[model samples]
Target: MVAVRDYKTALEYVQTFEEKDGLSAEQLMDSSVRGGLTYNDFLILPGKIEYPSSTVTLTTKLTRNITLNAPLVSSPMDTVTESEMAIHMALLGGIGIIHHNCSPEDQAEMVKKVKTYENGFINSPFVIGPNTTVAEARGLKEELGFSGYPVTETGDLSGKLLGLITSRDIQFVEDDTLLVSQLMSKNPVTAKHGITLLEGNEILKETKKGKLLIVDDEGKLISMLSRADLMKNQNYPLASKSATTKQLLCGAAIGTIEADKYRLQLLVEAGLDVVVIDSSQGNSIYQLDMIKHIKENYPKLEIIAGNVVTREQAASLIAAGADALRIGMGSGSICITQEVMACGRPQGTAVYQVSKFANEFGVPTMADGGVQNIGHIVKAIALGASTVMMGGMLAGTTEAPGEYFFRDGQRLKMYRGMGSIDAMKKTDKKANASTSRYFSESDKVLVAQGVSGSVVDKGSIKKFLPYLYNGLQHSCQDIGVISTAILRQEVDNGNVRFEFRTASAQLEGGINNLHSYEKRLHD
Candidate 1:
């Protein structure tokens, strides 16, 4: 037996030695006590930095083949993303998935509009026959918000370019039944089909013409150039576009029903870049069969599968040839899946686990929900997420689908989940009973996995997204990483560390004991 003094000396040695080690990402997550971990539960440790935040790069892949200058994606919810939102997202270096709650024809047209918005030339400009009435032209102008129509002998694009019609020609017309030919500008300025955009702009400026039709030698319309487009000179350096056609990249969502297959054909014909198999639970036989069918039929079209939270679910989708995995289940601000079904993991844990597993197979993963702030975005990227998909974060902006209203002196926009009762009711009455947006259609009574709500106005994506992009760069600078790829690598190698925040520490971190405060995102 050792002496009592020797035991005391050993105890003293243990007490004197201290451990200052930080927790790895995995350690911080796996050490969660009883409850699941969330983005707010922990904080990333600051690292050594030698460069400015402006030098940081945020480029990351949105899919196995598609890269985004910013690792951001707008959600496919109807109230969140549509043609306008999708176009703006692409312009800002992210992508948006057009929601499929509308008719297939309407959805396809939306996709077409995005692809047609920015092009070297408008290959298919809106055309009206010489017989089109002034009433019809006015209706077109009212509906499409443009009055410049190319008047062809026949209504078809391949017909002879008779002349051009502009607001100037129709503004003074009092007769509603008068044909467009009577009011059209005869012998309008024309450019040869092979003329470059610069040359076409020069002709427009010289002739003071609002519309410049590019025609073949036979005088058939080949393309058209707009004076407005030239004057705007909008340059989206990071716009997502196809390498071959240079059309803006667009995606559409589809369910696992038989009708969706027909819808997919229409979307693909409209130059859809990707298809998301939209479902709350993605491991169903319906989803698996649909994924296989799409991969077999449209091999080039990338498929983003699932709202899965577990590694096993991700593995199944990955084996089914999913190009990217959407991680998060009922983690949205409007989602109540966890509360109702008693299922679904926290968003942070789900993102980390699914992304880590998907990365092994060369498949990227997106954090689908629960992105309340910029810090949450940085945390998701550090956890190996290639892109973060936002619904609520982007919902209240100017580009969002719904109109803003004053609610108790606050300007707000309507934002409802795809699974909410309001969305289902507005979608289709008959289909609401059959379709399952949130996996609750099998129940006798429809139980909503999400709620209808409103978010405060956040101005426009033009200002908000840049703020997010800049804030993310600052976060990367703080982590001592210059790019999302490097950040993920450091996280994988246990170089990027984290620490769990206790209740007291969390209180200390926030603005506690304050009577009031004003929060402004950016100057």
Candidate 2:
């Protein structure tokens, strides 16, 4: 007997009455791509899928002798990536990039925090005194790049809080001698340290402030709470952006001989997967010697050297004991090196040219900066990045630094360029100022490229990563491939098709009445 049914009834019969027991789940996979996928894949966010799982190893191979579970890497943008976030990412199976925009000490502290996270014992924060002058507060914010301080009644947390200070309170205050009480918001709202994050958040909402100073039952400051902390706790705004525990390859920058020694020891103890010989120019003898030193000492360590734009510069570093090369000049949103210093390469040509040569040696390369979205990530991977290094794109998410702000019915995170003036003051080795020392150096406060704060809170990478993965998988599925490696092979084999046309062609296909969730349309 032959049976027939309409679309709705057929779907029901397949889901309910169809005989699925004896058949292997694999057989039905292709039959139900729609049902197997989440809404994210269905929407088809843009990205590339270079190879299929059945063909290539998704488990990325590191330079010297390391391996990673995930192919993902976090950007080193100051606003988006930091030590805490880096440690969390490593714990979860990815690497965290430390931005170069900050001072070596502050950046080192960020790295130290990542290291401290491993021991599980942490140095909690303490508040500066209320008597701390506005001039001092300004200096502190400038030096640390964060303003989560409250004024202590007795000059520190042992006493009560007479006022609250934030980056905003002293941002424009001209009276350097003015009492912090005059500058800081008075008797600001706070939360008891013992209170749950939920309870504290409720109190914070009622007060409408950027942070809630956590105190003991006796009202002594214990810790500070910002919207970033709250969201991370709740795994907001995206579960993918949540902090994870992945033992990851982490790299740091060191200029001086002493800094390099300490950095080297830290890398070894941390079981670092890769060490980047960070420099403004990759061809410098300093980097060459440093790379050689690291390889000779930690002969087992993998080294990625250079910020090179050409194969000529890249070759020298590669010959000087570099395992992989970092290619980019100044294509970063916050970087003005190409513009200011007039030395660098256009990112596309740089990747294409350097990757071409590096691939011959079987030594992989990483594309640093110049990535904005999933598509860019795909392109970089296709162009020869074992993995992509992002900076600004990863910033502003929950996993990134800073507190989230709610204003004008929208949520946003603080984002800045590494080369920006504010970042320079906080991380420059020359700053030689403590969080307490440079409480007022505004001339260096050049507020460069990102003053408009052009960043949105995409929740966290915990959620965002899944979105990217599923989206990429769907891209492969649609293109008739099974995994990322296969996609790359196909392109290499000339089986993957490429077409270039005017942008209008994008609208030429697809259903006009495809209807979005929020709106219904009819033909």
Candidate 3:
């Protein structure tokens, strides 16, 4: 029983001098048992909002040299990413890593396809000689999946332009041996090189022709345009492209084996923009040697190394001249590396520690795994990762490299890890055991680090990615930051606070009372 004035003074003093309500990222992490934590184990404390969500910017770096409008990346898993997925990811302001589970030639061709998908001018259009048979033209169409071919006198791109052959020219012709010259449209509409696509499109509309050939001053065919492509004009405003060629930027994955060097040569020739050295444990001597060798030989190429969790592993790769670091180990949803090998750190702790270490050296870091939702992505970035590399999150999209099938009343796409037994057993001769991504040990003993699974179809990435980007923007607004860079700065300065969630708190935070509910990810 104390006096009222004394009690009031004590209450005021306690209120004024109490410890800060929330923990800084470092403090929260240090308090964890052995510094181990996962994404869902903690929550970011909301801050006072000074701006609207729409005004928040999400731009961030993907590598030391490459910047992305959106800080998302698709994983380099065979069942997840390919040319289609890469193209869409780039268009949506992110980048995709093409898997190396196929032959070098096949992978190189995929890279070429992405680079040549859309261009201001077609520098290398298909050409046929005057003597080329109608059947041969049809075969070319079937193989290359294009119906229009420019007819040149010398059957080469440098030859003088003669005519153009289209599917209409051979629709009624039954003779397979008929020469293209006999049926092609002679003196077809032509546009000189250096004409804008708009000008070419106008000329095409006025001529009402299916094909428009762009020729040099000497009348040699240099490029071609199609009315179909113009009508279906797809514009990727956020697309990443080469500064010189204006071709789309693409990345591919490779192992540290000797054959990978030759494969990398082919990929570089195909105009690969970046290479991800695929390995579960990237601190190995083999990976370090490969990183050094590639940096010495291809000095201009950018290399992203690691699937490492600790600061030492990151230091080794960064010292070896890695342009970017991929941080994570055994934290992916489908991963079993920790259980099987009894190694690897929890994803949240790994990302925070490795990114903090790598940022000091001016190298960007990617949160490589354990991104199950948009909240996870926000947490990854808030932890100092420059970008979040997703696997299962992007695996079920329509652009992903797989067909959908129905099972248990749900449409799902196949998703598997590179080290899964099913993936290791794939019959691609070029993808031998040495290139079995996560497992580079003895070929005879199959030690799996992941599993084979399927994910529910999430529709197209066009919708899904926009939802994710908007979610991130809203998150930044809630965090009272106006951009990703600002968020990172605040996090590093300890201005951004966080709190660990107890088991009961997590349960209360989720929708627990509902007996049944239909979940909607986007509004």
Report the number of the highest-TM-score candidate. Answer: 3
lDDT of 1 at 261: 89
Could you give me the TM-score of model 2 versus the true structure? Answer: 0.56
**lDDT by residue for model 3 over 279-388, one digit each (tens)?**
98999998998998888889988999998999999999999999999998888888898999999999999999999899999999999989988899999999989999
TM-score of each: 0.86, 0.56, 0.87
What do the candidate models score in CA lDDT, each in turn?
Answer: 0.86, 0.59, 0.86
Q: At residue 47, what lDDT does model 2 achieve?
A: 30
lDDT of each residue in 1-523, candidate 1, tens digit only:
9645666577566557443258888787783552677888889999878899998998888889988899889988889889999988988888989998888888899999888887557788999899999999999999989899998988879999999888888898899999989989889888888887778878888988788899999999888988776654456666777766556788889888777888899999998999999988898888999999998999999999998999999988999889999999889999888998898998888888888889999999999989999999999998889999999999999999989999899999999888787877775443531155565545667777788999999999988988999999999999889888999998999888898888898889888787899989976
The digit string of per-residue lDDT tens for model 2 on 1-523 reads 7766777787567668534322221222122332221111112123344555333334454454545544566755557677766865665555676654444556666665565443211114446785788777777778866676777777766777666877787678778998777777877777655665557667666777767777677777666656645444354221112112221236554442434565557556644445666554678766777877787788876777777878899889878878888888777766676776667776755775687678778777778868766666665555556666767766776878788888788898877655555555564453322111112223444423322255766776666665555554555565556655655555455455443222354455334555554322111
TM-score ranking of the models = 3, 1, 2
TM-score for candidate 3, please give it: 0.87
Report the candidate with higher lDDT, 2 versus 3: 3
Candidates 1 and 2 compared by lDDT, better number: 1
Candidate 2 lDDT score at position 73: 68
